[model samples]
Target: MESTEWHLTSFVNLAVLTFLFLCSQGQVNGDCPADGRTWVPFGQSCYYFVHGNEDRFKSYTIEKAKEMCKDYGLLTVRSAEENSFIVENSLQVWKGGNNNMWLGMYYNSDDDEFKWNDESHVTFKNWEEGDAEDPEMPLIDTCVILHAASGKWENVSCSEQPQHGVVCETPQIRLQRKNASPLLSALVVISVIMILGISAAVWFLQQRKGSGSTLFPSFEYHPPFRAPSADQTCLVEAEEIDETS
Candidate 1:
């Protein structure tokens, strides 16, 4: 009896463990990717963030890139957590390569301040190397990040144009407009479909009617079988008499 009780307890414990294991696996499956990536949905664009590789290339000036992202309804790379996540995952992306890329920041000479494309103040400075300096031309005041091994922030004189990779920001207007007024659009589509269906039905009925008339003409005046006339009767009687004679 003692041995039987021990076996029953052991079985219960094993079943509990199995249930727990299954529950853990279920939780894992329901969670996000194990690689520490997140999904971003902005405008018509969808972005995935994974950490670790920074050796890709798609160069553009920061402003131009921001405009491009805006056109596609996306934002610039502005999150430290996201950046760190990407770094941790060792994911390669276009804007995080070896070359000095343009961020969504520029030096505004008129205002004598660093301004973001969104007209925000440039408080966050993370430049890399020999940037934002032109001893000969003081008027060439612009902000750019250095791409040296140190990867420090530097202020340098922006020349005519630099073909650098860019981090972009899509404008809010575009995203707000995308897929907006869905109910009305859907209603319009449904109405059009209904109209087309009704028109096709009418056309099909008309065609069927036309084909029926052609295939079987309607005879409105059908003649009936008539009895013989008086002349016909006299002729018949004369023929009968001849035959008898």
Candidate 2:
């Protein structure tokens, strides 16, 4: 019965630990700024579209678009889902105008590789057949743009080209609600209290157990030896003399 109870207690503690861990994870999240810009949430990051002319779909060169998103870096599509999302938003934002937009990727003819403007590694990619089939273009033809009709990337010359909007991606951010601090603090304190209380109760119960196992090590106690005082010694000698007489 004791063993069963102990196992049950262990299970309860494990469950509580798991719950608190999950709560902590949920408390911290990927959130963009509360600024006026409409930041669309994509896996672990936020995105904003900047065409500069919201009244009408206007296009900007790579340099101009970069300037427009000067506060934030140019869009770097890391995955297919992110690429698709950007294309969809561009179609909505640009409407009648050409939906082609500038990306952060640029061909590095020296390294014979493509690189993002922010220097992030190129892991996942979605490129059109023309881009992959064609031999590497010259360094001047390094810039990349997302084809609106099809969600694929295309290499284009960095020279004067048709106007295209730019997208901005913010740095990694963690979200915490202004009013949620006190609630989270209370939960943490309560969790700690519960764990300590359970531990103390378990200790007390173990100590109270009348088992052969001792709570503390046992040891023998011996009284210290002492020499007789002068009066006691004299009395002992007198008694001995009377006995001898």
lDDT of the candidates, in the order given: 0.49, 0.75
Candidate 2: tens digits of C-alpha lDDT, residues 56-161: 5566888887887777788888888888888887778667455777888877667677888776678888888768435665654768888777888887778746
Candidate RMSDs in order: 23.6, 7.4
lDDT of 1 at 19: 55
Model 1 alpha-carbon drift over 4 Å, by segment = 1-56, 61-67, 70-91, 94-97, 128-143, 146-151, 155-158, 170-245
Which pairs of residues have clashing backbones in candidate 2?
none
- Of the candidates shown, which would achieve the greatest TM-score relative to the real structure? 2
Residue 15 lDDT, candidate 1, scale 0-100: 56
Candidate 2 has an lDDT of 0.75
Highest lDDT scorer: 2
Query: In candidate 2, which residue ranges exceed 4 Å CA deviation?
Result: 2-7, 10-27, 52-56, 96-98, 132-137, 176-245
TM-score of 1: 0.36
